[model samples]
Target chain A: MQIPAPFEYVRASSVDNALALLDRHGPESRVVAGGHSLLPMMKLRLARPDWLIDINDLFELDYLLVDTVPNNGRVLRIGAMTRHTTLLESDDIKRLFPIVIDAERVIADPIVRNRGTIGGSLCQADPAEDLSTVCHVLEGVAVVRGPAGERMLSMAEFHRGPYETAVAQNELLIEVRVPIRDDSGSAYEKVERRIGDWAVAAAGASVTLAADGTISHVAVGLTAVGLDRNVTEVEAVLVGQAPTEQLFVEAGRLTSLACDPLADQRGPVDYKRHLADELTRRVLRAACRRAAASISDITI
Target chain B: MQISMTINGTFVTHEVEPRVLLVHFIRDDLRLTGTHWGCDTTNCGTCVVLMDGQPVKSCTVLAAMVDGHTITTVEGLANGATLDPVQQGFMEEHGLQCGFCTPGMMLTARALLDHNPHPEPLQIREAISGQICRCTGYATIVRSIQWAAEHPAGAAPETTTSESTEQEVHA
Candidate 1:
């Protein structure tokens, strides 16, 4: 019985047209890509915009490509309107960043995945959101375009807070760029109430091993655990250290201490902290295993 | 606002308010009530329909968003008196304790079969995981979909005695 309040609808033919519509409608406008999250919120009266600018026609904003940036090596560029199904099925995403696959598989069930977009997920920015943590661990940057032009914002800057993002009222997130590193592997682990529910507490890890079999670059991010951004202390413990069960145990302990989770229906604060610790260790172990395998793949 | 789309192979147009959800538009405006609306929220897949050959929650989609797309509801599953394999499978396997979740489940199964003609039991469960069947007939539902996969071209529709008796009672 829930329905959105009366609002004017306009479909954008292109990205430029989307921006122009946003400007024309002013602050009372919102761009709906997937409408999975926004429409539900609108129904609940959580988000009641005066105008809805539908950008579903902007097919140009739906892409997943690997671009070789000058002096920056190769990076995966995911368009804003790319559906979750595409990410789950993309061989490029599976091979380059398995973390995305890991997260996408559990983001929603197959039906919802057909319509939900990566850009919509990012813009929704729920605290329990999985992809944000995945992007943070992968060090992804967002390409946001406004009337002034485009700006690249790091994951840390792009995600302002729970249900908040850096995408301005008149701007659109055009693409997400994740640098592909050599000898690196990434993974995400989450525990939800059901098959496609929000995470109770999830963790993502990206690890790059040096020639000496030591961690060279590492990033760990946790979801729904009151952690606003990536855990630097966990990274500090694992960096330059050899990948070992004992080392992972230490990292897990550090992760437990670093996160601050609140008690709710999912679990108590203690249970969430426990999940944060265990999931972090699990991801680190899997990531390091894949990282070593990637090195072997290169040499072989 | 005016919108036009293909629903169940039929071209239709309507002047609906911008806020009208596709589920309501299909049922209330077009009088295609076979697509049940449930939970209002997107959690329940009772409002699922095929959009561009993929199953999407119609309750979450605006009618305006589907202005020029194709949608297939349960009404489209059968042609003339011939039933789709999915529909026959349901009848053969007794897939419904209550028929509320049947349409969405069948649409999802159809889409899954289209992409993967032969999905395993676990795959079938995964495909319909988003939907809720309060009847707790998941075991029978999965069996029904499996039966549909076994009969890809569909089989002759047969009327069971109990169903015929129930129909006569209603009549």
Candidate 2:
């Protein structure tokens, strides 16, 4: 019979209303979307906020838009209230970034996905959160709205640590922006103890191939291995290199050496590092293959 | 706080604490005991109920959050004395052993079939992956969903007795 402590609940009718409520409630209030992560923590007495402002009715924040105005380049804008199930079923998202689909499939389960929002997942900032890793690898930018105004921050700046984010007490994360690249593909690989358990170790990779078969851009992000962002050292090694098995192996070695994993029931440090290396290699290989296929599709 | 929503096709309003979970609201307040509560954590699927025709874990949802939404519990699956196709499918395919997970499983099956009329076996498995059925090993549960998909209009009257016999054999 788990239950949360007594609190005040208020529903915000619109985005401005939500922001106003947040401003009025001050630091003691927390905005809840989906409530999958927050409610569980509440039940455990881990997160006992004085006020919970429900933003589920802000339908204006539930959108998926692809903008190609050329001035801002091509970018995918996902509203903060977008649910995990919506992301899983979006064909546009599947065609643009399959890594999201891969991670969403293994996030929680169909039932949790129904109400879990992408904004809530990012805001929760669990060190092992899969969407954070996927967004990090893809270089996602978060658009946050506060009482003063709106500001955009990269994934690195947005995520301060586990359960912490740049979203202030009076601010709301409004949207996530991912830059779409031509001739590029992304993939995510995870190893978990069970079907819907948190990842023992997960890796996400996005690669862009040049016309001459060289890697123009590459990034690898890991989850549950104590790393906050993508593996910049591995990305540096593969950026200008050719798409070859040898390069992937070298990248894998660098990943294994660079990550700082902890020992727990999931695995010992060594095993987690091994998974980081192997999953990194797997995602990189898949990303390169998909990148090549994208190039071919463009040429055809 | 005061909240009103449509539950089992009936409009209901209740005053509940802000921290009350939707599952508690349904079972304890509304007295819809068919929706079982298990694993206070969100990991278990026994607390699943349809929110606006989509399966959501009610244990994690605040009652106030579903203010204007429509909820479908296992009790709503049947029409008067007639059983839903999913309920019939369960009885025909012997989907339950202890019956603790049946209500949630049937509601999920109904939601899946509503969205996808004919899902593959793999799809059915994936759809119910969040739920844990400690008794039936999930094979019969998958078969039960398949049975529902085949008999969308419910089982014929003549087949009821034979299906009961088959269910008895499995039990």
Candidate 3:
């Protein structure tokens, strides 16, 4: 039977209480959101923290809010404790960012979805993790709260490496902020070995088209291919160009070269590189199609 | 640490080590052996139990985390003498072969039917996707859940357990 090593457990009553507990417990303490990732690691003796501060009772952090900034369009703010099931069932999330729905649908099975939280998924930061790639493509900003104050980190800044994040020993990731664009649409495409397995190779794209059918803004992010950041080279090639098969082909070529994947159980480097190129193109095409549909909705 | 929670409509409290998983707590401590423990890595759904009416892998959840919550194990599915629709459905449809995966499957089916009374075949498959049933190939299991949906109130309780109850009366 697998079991975690004995540790001290404390249930934090509120966000402030959680932060205080984290601050008090110091580096040896870890705040568990959903415990899906942490508990598994604990059982394996991979993550043996001295103290586990349970943040499951912090109901204040469980929310999804759409705030309209005076100048910066609408921003979707997801509380860190929001569960995967809640995200999957949210119509607002479905209507605003279908890419999240696409990613969540394939994140895990419905049962695991009940207990896993977005905050925990992001913090786990396994290189092949789908949500980190999705957040990267969406240009999400991680709102982190520490003893000093609150600070926001970009996806690139938040994710330092596999199984590492910017959330400090005494800090908590409070929210993820994604700016909502007017004529924008995003999509995530992934190929996994099984139903709930991590992606073999996946790509997510967010595209915004100008009134004249030219791409105004675009970001492409990849997963499981050893890329910490999105493919800016692909964005440079597609931005200001009309959505075309030729442009997507060029973007795909750039993506295949951009990612650095190692041979593992999922696939060899060549196969994954091929997936990087192909999934990139598929997501780009799908995002562009959805963007065009959004434009049509606005016009209608 | 000390933890208290409602299990199967009964309020229970116990002192457990922080490392004790909810599955072990239920089975080893509470002796609710119906909730099977399999695949400690959370891949298998045999350890599934309803946490506040949602199916969660009990193997991954810490006992302390559920200190103030309500848990429903397979033993809780039937109300007194009457079998739950899902239990009756399993009996009628022959959903189990080795019965290793039945308890979790039934609890999940019960939760699904509570949320969505009439789930499509595809929905049922998706709902139970995390669970692995090597014995019946999931065909009979799916049919079993459909039977539960069809008979939400459950047909008159008729099972070996009921017969044993009658035997006790005769004795």
Docking band of candidate 3: medium
Report the lDDT of model 2 for residue B36.
91
lDDT of 3 by residue, A1-300 (tens): 889988999989988899899889888999898888899999999999999999998889899999975544789999999999999999988888989998999997999999888899999999988899999999998999988999889999999999989888888999999889878889998999999988999999999989987899999999999999999988778989899898888999999999999999999999999999999889998888888888874321
DockQ scores of all models, one per candidate: 0.76, 0.80, 0.79
lDDT tens digits, residues A1-300, model 2? 899999999999998999999989888898999998889889999989999999999999999999864444789999999999999999888988999999999998888888889999999999989999999999989999988999889999999988889999999999999999988989998999999999999999999989987899999999999999889998778988888888889999999988899999999999999999999999999999988888764321
Ranking by lDDT: 1, 2, 3
* lDDT (Cα, tens digit) per residue for candidate 1, span B75-151: 99887676777898899898898899999999998898888879999999999999999885599999999998876
Maximum-DockQ candidate: 2
Q: What is the interface RMSD of candidate 2, in Å?
A: 0.7
User: Can you rank all candidates by DockQ, best first?
Assistant: 2, 3, 1
Error of 2 at A219 (Å): 0.6
- Which residues of candidate 3, in runs, are more than 4 Å off? A70-72, A297-300, B157-171
Expressed as tens digits, the lDDT of each residue in B1-171 for candidate 2 is: 789999988999999999999999999999999999999898879989999999988899999899989999999988777688789899999999999989889999999998998999999999999999999999999999999888766765548776665434322
Query: Candidate 1 lDDT, tens digit per residue, A1-300?
Result: 799999999999999999999999999999999998999999999899999999999899899999987645799999999999999999999898999999998997888899999999999999998988998899899999999999989999999999999899999999999999989999999999998999999999999999988999999999999997999998778888889899999989999999999999999999999998999999999999888898864321
Identify the runs in model 1 with alpha carbons over 4 angstroms from their true place. Answer: A297-300, B156-171
Comparing 1 with 2 on DockQ, the higher-scoring candidate is 2
